[model samples]
Target: MKKIFIGMAILSAGLFTSCSDFLTEEPKQEQSNELTFATFDGVNKAAAAMYGMFQSDAWYDGEFTLMSELRCGNAKNPTSVPGSGRYRSDTQWIYSDRSTSPLWSYAYYTIARANNVINNLDDKVGVDATQQQVNNVKAEALFIRALCYFDLVITYCQPYNYNATEDDKMGVPLVLVTENGKPARDSKENVYNQIVADLLQAESIMADDYVRAGVTDKAATPTKPAIQALLSRVYLYMNKWQEAADYATKVINNKKYELAPADAYAAMFSAATAPEGGEIIFEVYGSDKNEYWDNSGWAHLPYITTTDDKGSHGDVCATKDLYDLYSEGDIRKSMYKQHGNDYFPTKYSGKPKDSDPKYTNVPILRLSEMYLNRAEAIINGASIQGVTAESDLRKIATVRGASQTAAATKQGVFDERRRELAFEGHIAADYARCNKSMTRKDFDDSKNKDVAFPSYMWALPIPNRECTANPNVAQNPGY
Candidate 1:
């Protein structure tokens, strides 16, 4: 499927919080100035732009991992760049330093884009677009906004306070409407409420018509499945285990998405050739033409390399502990390459020399995650022993025909998730939801093996620029 650009209608300014300048470039006088959200095509383009924000390193490659490390108790040393570069070798990363962090800023950038869509969508001047198109666009925008807020809250603010009222807790900023002026941070409860409202609205709007097998569907955008997947994640974070399990089960059995075969896990990551694997429900697809190596998945993930077809940059190898989690006879073990006694994932290796490295779109949500989630939620909600009660947990585990049977214990499922979903941006969040202790010692002994957690993970201080722009905002705890 040919990729579509959303903000093509909006002028591409460097950065702006204004609704008018959100996605569209300034309209050329030659074209009619009266374009409105009346058609599927126009609205679809705007929806497409939301995904672009994810492709940018500002959101995914850089800020995304930085936030994960914060919660996971992994940080680099003060002498090194705090959050940039391949964290392949032994480099100390400090979590306290404000200089090297871009998370808060990048999150706002995404929020601004989402705000632009929400604000301008209802005002579309054209009538050709139906109420359904407008609703779809709005729902998608809401979904994006909720996702960004959830991302910000988990990293910058404290975890969800189920006991507090929406206005009392300290949550991240909630920019529902686009603003030309500065805005203050909203309470954490307010942010959560807004996220829930947005997701509910998205689920309703999406209904059943928004199914897309891959990135090919021209009308591709979040569907009921995507919204449910996110809600499952949100509820899990909020400690609503039964709700999380229920939502996750809905997706797992929905027939809209499915888990990929364990044997195909290696090939599912190939950028050029991997068929849209069954595991993916939604993703931010990127193209070599539109993206560069530093920002591309092919360039950043270490396992996909040239010489070994399993190693790249000879760095960022999977942790020995993580590697060992897989048992003998587990076919997924083949996904990693252990050349020269070092283990690297084979998932993202670039094609052989000179050939354009295929860049598979990163999976934002997948069936495997939903399965793991169901297991966790069920275990958290009502722990039961044996096959009948532990059925959900067992279904996800024992894949690859390994000796490690499905675990009835919390540790078993948790360990299974770490191995099954390694490096896909789930580890830290999973740990947080589970309320596991995140300390420097854990990373040093595990993933990083030799690295210590920098104080920065407590929360990267809000950027100076943001504080200067909006004085009401306060820095996170210990930052």
Candidate 2:
């Protein structure tokens, strides 16, 4: 039954660019030769596939700019592969023809999935069975779509395109329809408006009850918490600090999720029970038999282990800066182990007891992050208070073994975020907020051995495909 669901789910969800004039047609199965998405299960399965894209090689497998491009900080080493190492130019303060790079396709591929879900969902059938269920499903789809758009805008377009006369700022293609036809880019401000609209509607629709956070039941969908969490993150990126603080506070005060204990910190990254950890508000589970290990294998493992395990791609190591960041008594240092001069990040450490290698589910949102974000937002946007903001956030991380204290300043909050959320894809965003830059020496500990922030890398260049195919699309200045 699970296999059937996985298979139908992949077929029903769209994950490629729609750049031709192909007409929309219902997905047909070989056995029945009939459209298969009229049922609720069919639609649900399709949505699962779209959510699954977050874990694929396109985004998390070290291919996505989240780690590869030197847009944020230095990589641990110059030991990067072909498609992933283009950001080295940024370290040298050079920008060339990266506008035509291949990484852009990942953005479009994700957008295609969002388009498929938005296009195929029909209210007529869904409303007949359960209006609430239908709305919940639609809300989940919209949230996913919004996430894709948000990623594209931050990655490809300039930061808010603040000065452009509406027409000059190139936004991503807003392909709301599933038809295979190219669409021109929207303005940056226009794209922001759409993103805000999607999140607002999604929160309203998801206000009711639903299941998320590792619940694999066919009926499960994103709930209000997930929507709110993403909203807080979006607002933070947009510099809407008050709004970000409000949403972050909302989730923090809800009192539903709690941070794991100090002992459970290691378990939070353990493959065995990570999905069950109360902190994980959204995550993707993986199985050895399936292709969806969330790229934990590719992102965390190093090439040529001391044991000489050639199983995983020979890449990814924790830099000495990250290693030295841990204090002498901090228990968090256990999360990584030294295999010599190089330290291997243990967030996805292989399983114990000689079983098949396993990695924890990729965590998308967690309550601990909410605490840090609320603290940052409060300090950035509102009046500074010790107990309410700084003390409150520090209390949690302290109990959870984070060695840092909360300070109500940009540097303090920034450092807290870096140490606490390290490698969870939050540091790159921080670079944008502080407007900092980094160097190749930072990338490999052998050179800089210290961390520096590069502000320009915060807004990633729009994927190469959009600029090449759409004449209206513009590339980021330095790329």
After best superposition, candidate 1 residue 288: deviation in angstroms?
Answer: 1.2
For 151-232, candidate 2 gives per-residue lDDT tens digits of 7776655566244344336666665654444456677677777888888888887645576424442122356887888888
Q: Tell how far residue 248 is off in model 2, in angstroms.
A: 1.0
- Displacement of the residue 391 alpha carbon in candidate 2, Å: 1.7
Clash counts for the predictions, in order: 26, 18
Candidate lDDT (C-alpha), each: 0.56, 0.54
Candidate 1 local lDDT, 169-249, one digit each (tens):
577666665534455677777787788888988888764665422344222247778889999888877877777777887
Predicted structure 2: lDDT? 0.54
